[model samples]
Target: MSIFKKVSESERNTKATIFVGNIDPKVNEIMLYELFIQFGKIKSLNLPKDRISKTHQGFGFIEFKTEADLKYVVQIMKGIRLYGKLLRVKQAENKSNDTKSVSNKPRTVDIGAKLFIKNLNPLIDEKYLEDTFSTFGEIISTSVDREANGESKGQGFVVFNDFTSSDNAIKNINGKILMNSKVVVTYAYKDDKQKTKHGDKVERLLATNAKKHKMLDSSTQPTKKQKR
Candidate 1:
């Protein structure tokens, strides 16, 4: 009969994803860290960047070392005032299944070089992006921006396992996509440290937002009184 009984116990309770919006444009994840780390041990923190200006949109994700940490933070963060926005915190998304594609995760075999990809469509995702580039070389990793809720920023990074492969990808992909106006691919350094924080930020920001969503049960449809 507990109010939260319907909230099933999560298996991986330690990690969480949080959403952040209504943020102060000037505030970044580093500033958020200073505020949220008070709850527990923080393993990782991310502040997804705005595709246009590379600035944060006042939201990001934080991962603590244990579930107790996650719960503690949620309890402490709800309705808490910081950056002029009442923070919404909750469990992070489980993207582990989506990451199973070997083409996506960090390639242990270093490519000894990085390549920049250009002309990507704003609608594509990290996996699809990798496939387009994989034909040219062994890709070590990839990232598409989580801009505007769920759109790519027409930019990304693809790290090859070898310089020859990287060179080959550039030679083949550069002008080919341009044929139909898809995008022209270019060999460039894979986006390095920048991605780490932002990816985490995007994931958390989304998860946090989801938690605050309002749901209506059809069987118990609200009456005028309930509506009020």
Candidate 2:
């Protein structure tokens, strides 16, 4: 009976998730699982392969059955050098944009790259968000955040290739409210923005990091707190 209690407690506290970063383009699911398995029991390994390109998406998710393993990897490995690159392993983004594709049911305006949206609905599934946006434009992409249960974290990115379509989308539905959630629209920048805010010294550091941080691009805008 004591052993059973111990096992149940272990199961509850041992579960956690990590967003594996700085993956070598050549790395595959099996290698990743083997590498992280050292941390603890792996609940799942999700590496998105581009359906069109059938290549690695450069990032993947690793889930552990317990919080101990998850917390251990997130802290000790968050900035540890892996494969000559500094891996940004941390708790996955709680909120992300998810894409929904809608082939039918056109809207009054087209949504293009001009407008950007953030602050998403956690309960709304990714497909639901994509379908809503598809009514506006030819979507570029929708990024939805997920947890172990594969539930939305309630924030995501929506991009359109055309500016006018974005403007038309804003005019028609900026504040109409969908999915029982209000949306905020703004312009989005690359992750490089963070480096510029502190100073040249910091920017140089960030640039150097970008060399190994395959997750971030050279032009990514930094977070607001990092702004100059």
Candidate 3:
């Protein structure tokens, strides 16, 4: 007998949802509902299927009536093994404000507009990085390195659609303080030798600029005679 057969329509509330990943294709909604319903009452469960083959898409969403239940399930399901795989469970990001009206096609990346950034605050993630730099231009993608435990690796890359936007970002944001940490932003280089050579040059320039700024500030201060 299917467990979902007993779920009444009145119990449905698709408010708080969580994303479940690494799902086996053989797993069905009935098995999922039976597994998750042990923690809380589920409003809805969805495993997207291909139109032609009708196989599970290897991911699903589970909606619960209350936020408390949703949180509880996420906490308990963090490392739970199912179908010989460790399930990846997390809170689903709200896409209500997403620009879905725009075309769904993937944006083209301008190789010249790719940037490499380092010394990121551990708290900064891909979404935060995107939000911080989105004002410069239409971003194609943002990626932050992470450890297996999901800790930030303090480095990332951002790609924009045009070179001008990336240039503007380097001018305005390089050496700027983000989350109490100064970050280094530079053009991403494909060759190791080029990256090292350019990195050294940028470091030297930054040091020289810092020294020049200190001298300029000291020179501008009024001496006793000048003040008199």
Candidate 4:
């Protein structure tokens, strides 16, 4: 199988929740709700706490009513300099998976008003992204993905207030050269949360391969010649 699979026409659309990680230990769900509320309507905000200390676990999950809002949070809030640390954000796994086997397919999700732009120049910053995409419409926020050492990750996101603006930017700015490299733009896959399922598949494949290797080893072993 190819390492990089082309997103199906159906996968282009999605997001409803995101996993917020690397959060400040002191941050509470109320603070999180306050911070994320600006992006869109929220469905739920959960911050697991230590049963004894009554302290947060340093990570939480936030659910938005619309995929657009969820994408906005994932894209624009990631790597944000908050509380003297950068925040890590991504799609949240299904809560139901804790009780049952996860399905390969995710639930139906709505398309968000955000775009994922890749193949970017390492030097590109959030300002450059905003400036470039602003031509299409008002940009609510922007982000340049980066490494832990503060180096650019050669990718970023641009979030518009409306889906129309995002679509326009994708149509006009996608594949355009930026800093000598052509960029790829597409709708953010904000609702995708299949990491656990993928890991399961990998484990199963390795087990199967191990069994095959054992059988081959036994079959290939030389038999002792019988005395005639």
Best by lDDT: 3
lDDT of 3 by residue, 84-200 (tens): 445667776543321121111022212335688999999886667778887776664566666776667788777554455666788889999999999999877745555332234
lDDT of 2 by residue, 100-191 (tens): 11211111011214344555677664356556765665544444545555555555555443444444566666666776778776544434
> What's model 2's overall lDDT?
0.49
Choose the strongest candidate by TM-score. 3
Residue-level error in angstroms, candidate 4, position 17: 32
* Clashing residue pair totals per candidate (backbone < 3 A): 12, 34, 0, 0
* Per-model TM values vs. the true structure: 0.38, 0.37, 0.43, 0.40
Residue 222 in model 4: shift from native, Å? 76
* Between candidates 2 and 4, the lDDT winner: 4
Local distance difference test, per candidate? 0.48, 0.49, 0.61, 0.57
lDDT of each residue in 1-228, candidate 1, tens digit only: 121121222533335534343344456666777777777766566655533335553345566677787777777776554433334455665444322343322112322335555566665655575677667655545655445445545666665544555556666776565324456555452244442322233433443343334221121121221100
Ranking by lDDT, best first? 3, 4, 2, 1
Full-model lDDT, candidate 4: 0.57
Q: What's every prediction's RMSD, in angstroms?
A: 18.5, 16.3, 16.8, 19.9
Let me know the TM-score candidate 3 reaches against the reference structure: 0.43
